[model samples]
Every structure is written in C-alpha cells, then in structure tokens.
Target: MSQLGKFITIILATSTLALTGCASKNKKSQVMVAPLGVGHGGNMGGYYGGPLVNNSDAIRNAARNIQGVVYFDFDSDAIKPEAARILDQQAQFLNSNQGARVQVAGHTDERGTREYNMSLGERRAAAVRSYLAGKGVNTANIEIISFGEEQPAATGSNEAAWSKNRRAELSY
Candidate 1:
C-alpha cells in the first residue's frame, strides 16, 4: 500500500478506537448498573429504598425553633407534655409547607424483645402522628415507620440512651 494510504488507514483506526472509548466512558458515567436484587425495582430486603430524607429549610428552621426531639418514658407510647410545644411547632411547619411530606420514625432502646420493641416503636410513631393530625396537619402527608430497637440515637443502655431512643424522629 502507498505510505499516504497506510497513514490514512492508521489514523482512521485510531480515531475509531478513540470514539469508541469515549462512548464507553460516557456510558459508564451516565448509566448506573445496580447489582442483582438492588435498585428501585428490586426488593432491597424488608427496607424500602428511595431518595434519602432531607429536611427542607422550612422544616429545619422549625425543628431548630423547637430545640430537639422530645423524650418519652420507658415503654410508653404517649408524647410527654414537654413535647407538645415541639409538636406544635412541627405541626405549624407542616401546615405551612403544603407540598412537603414527612415521615415519623419511632425508635426504642435495646431493652425489650425485637417484636415488642417494634410494636412500641410503632405506637410511639402513632402518638406523634396523631398529635400532628390533631394540630391540623394533614394525615395524608405524614407517614410512620418503626425501627423498633434496631436503631438507637444513643448506644448506651443507660438512662440517657434510653431517653434519647424513646422518641420519634421527623424526616421530610
């Protein structure tokens, strides 16, 4: 073959290879391939997978205004009197942020059976949800999830830990 023809062939091959490489790289970056039994369509065990809950600026501001999570007594599902003020603030925020939805996660200390704790956690979440609904927040926008004793705000088995665990977390 002529030198010019050979060079042209080489250039064409290299250009083709480069273009293929670029396409592959673009696909790699843009397309996320989840492993088997993962992603949105797959069953991620018992847990639901979706967007991470992020508190809106309004919700965060409201939470900050209220101070912090309210505590409940051991094995109780009732929201304490002190928590009413915080719930009131949260209710106001929910009422104002009509487009936002919230999830109330209930947790408990590692002191009871997993099943019992799960029930307790659910009750705790229900208590919070009921309070918010009573305060004029729409029930449709609020969800409840019970973590039971699986998740703990404080790890210790002491009073402080138990106190922190026996509460509901508001997420949006």
Candidate 2:
C-alpha cells in the first residue's frame, strides 16, 4: 500500500476507537434527569440491562406523607401562625431527610391581574422556602415555583373559594 493509504487506515482506526469508547461508557455513573424539585438521588441509575426505578414518584410520595399545604391571607405573602406550624412539620421532615428535595408551589386567588398574581405567588413560595431554610433545611434542596391563579384549590369567585386558593403546596 502507498504511504497515503497507511495514514488513512490509521486515522479511521483512531476514529473508530474513539467512537466505540464513547458508546461503551458506563450508564450507571451518569446522573439522571428528574423534574424541577426532584434531585438526582435515590435509585435513579438504570438502563436496558438494569432495573429502572421511578425516582420522581418515590420522592413525591415520601414528601406527601407530611403536612404539605399552608394557607395565606389575601394578597399577603406573610406566614400566618397556622402556616408557621405547618412549615415546622415540613422543615423537620426535610431536616431529617437531607437527601429529600422539595418544591414549593405558590398559588394566588383570581382577583388580580395575571402578572400581579404571578408575582404574589412567587413571593408566597419564596416565603415558605425561606421559612424552611431558617429552620435549618438546606436551601439548595428547595425549589420554588409560582402558579399564580392558574391552579386554584377552589373554583368559585367568592371569598371562601379565594381563601382556599391563596396557598402554597409542597412537593418533592
């Protein structure tokens, strides 16, 4: 063979080896992707040859076992006395389970504009997250989301319904 032929063969072999190396990498060592608040933990490693576990479901179920809802007054992000009690329980669970990741979802009544409601929702969620962090829960493990009036606990346009709608819910 000519010198050019030999050089071409070597390059092809190197490229093939590199591609094979990439394709054969261990999937177990790779991090798994989950939802916003669900961190990459638990038995998340699985591929065609391994057993796959539903980690997001597991995390959410675990978190659901506690007091996961806190109510707020109209147009207020302030933590009420009752809300503080609920947060205390949530914080204790989070502190005990350091690996647990929590998502704080804030919601508002439909009395305001969408933009204003969204901002209020964010403040409510942030307030809950802050309270949990103050109680020694890791802030990194907490995620906050604002649903505004999009997700309401109650459907009617009355004070009773609005009162129920103004709240934050926790999920893992």
The candidate that achieves the highest lDDT relative to the unseen native structure: 2
Q: Output candidate 1 Cα RMSD.
A: 15.3
- As for candidate 1, its clashing pairs are none
TM-score of 2: 0.66
User: Could you say which candidate leads in TM-score?
Assistant: 2
**Regions of model 1 farther than 4 Å from truth:** 1-48, 51-68
Please provide, for model 1 over 5-31, each residue's C-alpha lDDT reduced to its tens digit, 9 standing for 90 to 100. Answer: 999999999999977775433321111
lDDT of 2 at 97: 78
What TM-score should be assigned to candidate 1? 0.65
The residue-by-residue lDDT of candidate 2 on 1-172, one tens digit each, is 9999999999999999987776555643112222222222332211122222223666667767788899999989999999999999999988877777776778899899877887898889889988998999988787777767766777797999999999998876
C-alpha lDDT (0 to 100) for residue 141 of candidate 1: 76
Instruction: Quote the positional error of residue 165 for candidate 2 in Å.
Output: 0.4
lDDT for model 2 comes to 0.76
Worst 10 residues of 1 by lDDT: 27-36
